[model samples]
Target chain A: MLFYDCSTAPNPRRARMFIAEKGVEVESRDISIAKGEQLQPAFRAVNSRATIPVLVTDEGTVLTENLGIAAYLEARFPEPPLMGRSADEKGLVLMWNAIAEQQGGAPVADALRNGHPAFKDRAIPGPANHAQIPELAQRGVARVAQFFDLLEERLNESPFIACDHFTLADISTFVFVDFARVIKMRVPEGNTATRAWYEAIKARPSAQI
Target chain B: MLFYDCSTAPNPRRARMFIAEKGVEVESRDISIAKGEQLQPAFRAVNSRATIPVLVTDEGTVLTENLGIAAYLEARFPEPPLMGRSADEKGLVLMWNAIAEQQGGAPVADALRNGHPAFKDRAIPGPANHAQIPELAQRGVARVAQFFDLLEERLNESPFIACDHFTLADISTFVFVDFARVIKMRVPEGNTATRAWYEAIKARPSAQI
Candidate 1:
């Protein structure tokens, strides 16, 4: 199997951490997002969307999104199930992962892409260039603050993001929370539960990558 | 199982159609998004996110996102599988589904919410109110057109959005294509491949709902 990754990006890190947790050995190539390498013809041939964290299985099928990459890996390596064990658990894992994407990941991305000069005409990621909206950048910071509260509330009630055990939800949420630094956001000092959960996951071997 | 629905919304329709295709009997309650019923205290108690298409399982687990609801239902009823039959197919299903969401569904939503007067201070969905960005409205219209092209390209090569058989990807893409009407967007007349694919899915009994 072959993996297309971007070392500094949060989305790719989620896939990287998942692969590490599963103890899977796969060849990888990094396509630098910082250098605008993803928009070049070579990367576009691999994924027309020009996105990273793509997995090309032995069958030569290219999985372009994080959801697909993680789902395939979880299915292939069922020993240490990171998705979930039971039917309901599976549902919760996906649901919470969606929350992490929509609530946590999105606002952080918006704040960076819309507010940063480096992303002047690149508010949205893809093969195209989109102009940034200053209003969205301001709103993103506010929403990110709310995301921290949401995480704190959820973590206070449960040992992990989805349930008592570590799962895909934790991986997704952790990456987003950690990536919040790009927007000058962090788990608020008062959010003890979220802080504790973040510290615990930060200690994991898979997260070290 | 009890399902929370809003007949007029595209996201809720995705869940309704999935339930219909599965031929499962689920007790449902309509939450009028037009009436702002989702923001009511009662609805907020069920789903703090204040979104429609929530599923309260027989086990009393509340699923607030479409991904979670679909995953739970698919696991419970494996027949007429809407996800996929194989590992690669499953990955493709989700990958295309994400594309439909990011490229199709999101742009359509942004155009409508940012351009329509009815959505003033409601640019983003969920519990909070956010003002619209006119720049995003213009960008959304352009992106929606590109999304039609992307679908046309994919459909020309494959019968369905994901693979040989219909799956969750088709359902998501179909709903987004149909919802483009709200933003005054339609399948371009020259994109015959997309038109044919859209019409085929439109004929499905599940889509009629």
Candidate 2:
């Protein structure tokens, strides 16, 4: 498989970390968002959406989204079982992962795209040129704080976000929590449970990658 | 299960439609965003994020994300297999679902939350208060258009967004496409393949609910 990645982006980083977690290796190509290479014709041919973290299987099938890539890798390498094993476990994994994406990942993107001057005319992810909105960043900061609170509440109840094991939900949530630092949001100093869980997950070899 | 829903919101509608598609009967309570009921402390107790479309399971588990509710429902009622049966199939379902969430749903939300005057001082989800950004709406419009193009390109190659059969990806995509109407954006006029697929999916009994 050939994986098109962007080192700076959170979404692609999720995929990269997942692949590393599964102990799988693929030919990696950098799609530099900093230089706007994703908008180039050569890259557009790979994905019309002009996004990164695309995985092209040896069969010539293109998987263009992070969840897709993660799912594929999880299924192919089931030893670690990042998604989950049983029916209920799978459901929990999916649930937590979605929450992380919507509550955590989305807000980070909103803040970055709307606040960062580097993305001035590229608020959206595709090839199109769309201007930024600085106000969204302020809102994003508030939403992210809430996200941290939500995670704290969840972590207080379960050792892991989904099942009792470390799943893709953990990966997504970890990335989101770490990414929150960029927006000047931290896991609240008072969120003891969340901080402990975050430290534990961070120590995982997969997280280091 | 009891579902907290809002008829007008796209995310809640996706969960409602997924339950409908699964042929499961859920006790649903409408949390009116227009009325600001989602901000009530009563609702916040159920979901700290204060987002709509939360599912309270028989086990008293409160699932707060659309994908979370869908996952739980699909697992509980597996006869229809909304995710998929095989590994590759599962990967495709997850891939397309993420694409729909990121490309279709996220942009629509960016447009609505940032553009709508109604969401002023409530730009982000959760109990916190934040203001809106009108400029994000313009970027949202452009991003949503690009999303349509991406969907059209995918639909042109396959009957469903994922594989040959209907799955959660289709459910999510259908809700997103239908919800885009709120922003006055419909599927592009000339995309015959997408239109046909949309009609067929729309005809499903689940879509009406």
Candidate 3:
């Protein structure tokens, strides 16, 4: 298997952390998002969507999205089961993962893409270019603030984002929370549970990648 | 098990179709999104996120997101498997499903929510009020057009969105393509492959719901 990664991107980092946790080795290559390498024709041939964190399976099937790559990895390497162990646990994992992506990741991307000068014409990712909207940048920041609150509440209930143990949900949430710094936000000083949870995940070997 | 539904919304419809396809019976109550019932305190008690198609499992666990609900049902039922039968197939299913969502559902929602007066101050979902951006509306329409082309290309390669047979990816893609009509878009006349695939999924009994 071959994995395409971007050292600076959050989505790829989630997959990277997952791979680290599974202790699986896949030939990996880095695509420089800062250099706009993903939009070039060579990478485009591999994934027409022009997104990073793609995994080409042994059979040559290209898995483009993070969810797809994670699903494949978890199924193929079931030992450390990052997704979940049971029916309800699986549901919770997916639920929290989606929440982290939608409520946390999406907003952080919006705040950065629409607010950053470097992303002036790249507010949305993919093959196409989208002009930034200042209003969206403002909304993104506000939503991210709310997302931190949501994480704090969830963490207060359980040690991890999804359940009692570390799972893919934690990986997703951890990445987004760390990435939130780009938007000049953090787990509030008062959100002790979320702050503690973030620190714990950061100490993991998988997180260092 | 109790299911909360909104007959008019596309997201809930995706879960509803999945349930119908699986031939699973769960007592369901309609939450009138049109009436802003999703935001009321009563429903808020069930799901603070103010989203619909929530499933309260037999164990009293609340599954809020569509993916979560689908994961729970797929695990419990495990027949006529919509997620896919193998590791590779599961990855492909999630990949295609996400493509349909980011490429199809999101843009459709963006166009309508930003352009339609009915969605004023409710551009983004979940217990929040966000002013719409006209630029996003324009970008969304353009993206939705590109999504049609993406679907056309994929349908030409495979009979179904993800694999040889119908699966969760088809459910997600079908709902989004149908919902695109709200933005005054349809499968283009020349895309025979996509038109045929859409027609086939539309003919399914689950779609009739």
Candidate 4:
């Protein structure tokens, strides 16, 4: 399998951290986003969407999204299951992972893309150029602040984002929260539970990447 | 199993259609979003998110999102599978389902919520109130138009969104495309392939509910 990744991006980092946790050996090619490499014709040919963290399986099927990459990897390497073990667990894991993507990942992305000058005319993805909406940047920050509160609430009750164990939900949350640094946001200092959880995950060897 | 649903909502309709396809008997309770019933104390006690399409399993786990409900049902009833038949197939199904959610579902929602007077102070979900960004409404309309183009392109090459057989991916795409009506968006008249696929799914008996 071949993985197309960007060393600095959050979405790709989630996949990178996931692969590291799984101890999988796959060839990697880094596509630099800062250099606008993802928009290049070569990358577009690989994924017309021009997104990174794409996995080209041996069957030549190109998996374009983070969930796809995580799902395929979890299915292929079931030993250390980052997704979940039982039927109930799988459902909850997926639910929370989707929450992480939708609630956490998306807002962080909005704050970054809409506020950053580098992303002007590129707030949305794909082969399109959408001008940044300043109102969206403000909205995104407000949303992220609320998202942090929600995570703290969820993490306080459950040891992890989804449940008792570290799963893809945690991976997704960690990546998003870490990326929130770009927006000058972090877990509120008073959110002790979230801070503890963040520290624990940060100490993981997979997080070193 | 008990399903909490909103008849007019797309996400809930996704579960409704999936359950119909599976031919499973699930006791369902309607949570009316139009009346703001989801915000009531009783329903909030069930799903604090105030979102419908929640599945309360016999095991007493509340599956809150479309993916969670779908995963639980697919696992419990594996007949005429709407998820997928294999590991690779599952990955592809999820990938497309996510595309439908992010590209199709989200944009349609943005257009409706950000532009509609009824959704003022509710541009974003959850307990917090976010003011509508009129600019986001325009962005959403543009995004939905692009999403239609992408769907048309994909449908031209494949009979189904994910693969040969219908799966959750098809269910998500169908629901989102249908919900686009609320945003005054539909498949362009010239997009024969998308129109054909949409019409075929529209004929499904499950769609009637």
Q: Best lDDT goes to which candidate?
A: 3
Q: Write the per-residue lDDT of candidate 1 for residues B123-151, one digit (tens) a residue.
A: 88899999988888898999999999898
Report fnat in order of the candidates: 0.74, 0.69, 0.74, 0.54
TM-score for each predicted model, relative to the true structure: 0.99, 0.90, 0.99, 0.98
* lDDT of residue B4 for candidate 2: 93
Interface RMSD values, listed in order for every candidate? 0.9, 2.1, 0.9, 1.2
Model 1 pairs whose backbones collide: none
Kindly report which residue pairs in candidate 2 clash with one another.
none
lDDT (C-alpha) at residue B104 in model 1: 92
Q: After superposition, how far is residue B208 of candidate 4 from its true place, in Å?
A: 1.1
Q: Summarize candidate 4's per-residue lDDT along A24-137 as a digit string, tens digits.
A: 999999999999989999999999988888999888889988887887887788979887777677789888988888888898888889989999999987788999988888
Better of 2 and 4 by lDDT: 4
Model 2 regions more than 4 Å off: none
The lDDT of each candidate is 0.91, 0.83, 0.91, 0.88
Report model 4's TM-score to 2 decimal places.
0.98
lDDT of the structure predicted as candidate 2: 0.83
lDDT of 2 at B193: 86
TM-score of 3: 0.99
The residue-level lDDT of candidate 1 at A98 comes to: 89
- TM-score of only chain B in every candidate structure: 0.99, 0.96, 0.99, 0.98
What DockQ, on C-alphas, does every prediction get?
Answer: 0.82, 0.59, 0.82, 0.70
Per-model C-alpha RMSD:
0.9, 2.5, 0.9, 1.1
